[model samples]
Target: MSETNGAWTWRLEDTSGTVVPVSEEYADQHFASQGDAESWVGEFWRELAEQGVVAVTLFELDRQVYGPMRLDTN
Candidate 1:
């Protein structure tokens, strides 16, 4: 079953674990399913990394599914 928008989202952060401020237009970065969220991150992670986002955490509402996954390709 799929969750509502904002139910499945990511918490982007830098290497120091500081939350990265997302632009207002990108604030609604929600997904219906985990796969959808993962795919979106896979596609845009490079751009995010470029913007100083070194890691990301997946969330289901207030629940953390998994992550703080490093964006480093090394």
Candidate 2:
């Protein structure tokens, strides 16, 4: 999903490769650019871990930019 025209989305995911439900708590997961998405994950991954997000992924349309990056160290 597009955050805005010419922008990207920071999608939160579960271990099953399903998109996590978007909530008021995570309203900003979609970002203005890839860098912004990465930055959001970088800053809040620990919080995401607590919320049961095992991995994260990025996309522009059906194209995956990157991810499935793990939040848990173990």
Considering summed lDDT, which 10 consecutive residues are worst modelled in model 1?
1-10
Best by TM-score: 1
Candidate 1 on 2-72: residue-level lDDT in tens?
23444799889987888898665444588888888898889888888877789999998899999999988
Over the stretch 21-67, how does candidate 2's per-residue lDDT look in tens digits? 65556644456677777777788788787777789877875688888
Candidate 2 lDDT (Cα, 0 to 1) = 0.72
Q: Per-candidate RMSD vs. true structure?
A: 3.3, 3.0
Q: Which candidate is the best by lDDT?
A: 1
Model 1 TM-score on a 0 to 1 scale:
0.84
Q: Runs in model 1 with CA error above 4 Å?
A: 1-4, 24-26
TM-score, predicted candidate 2 vs. hidden true structure: 0.75
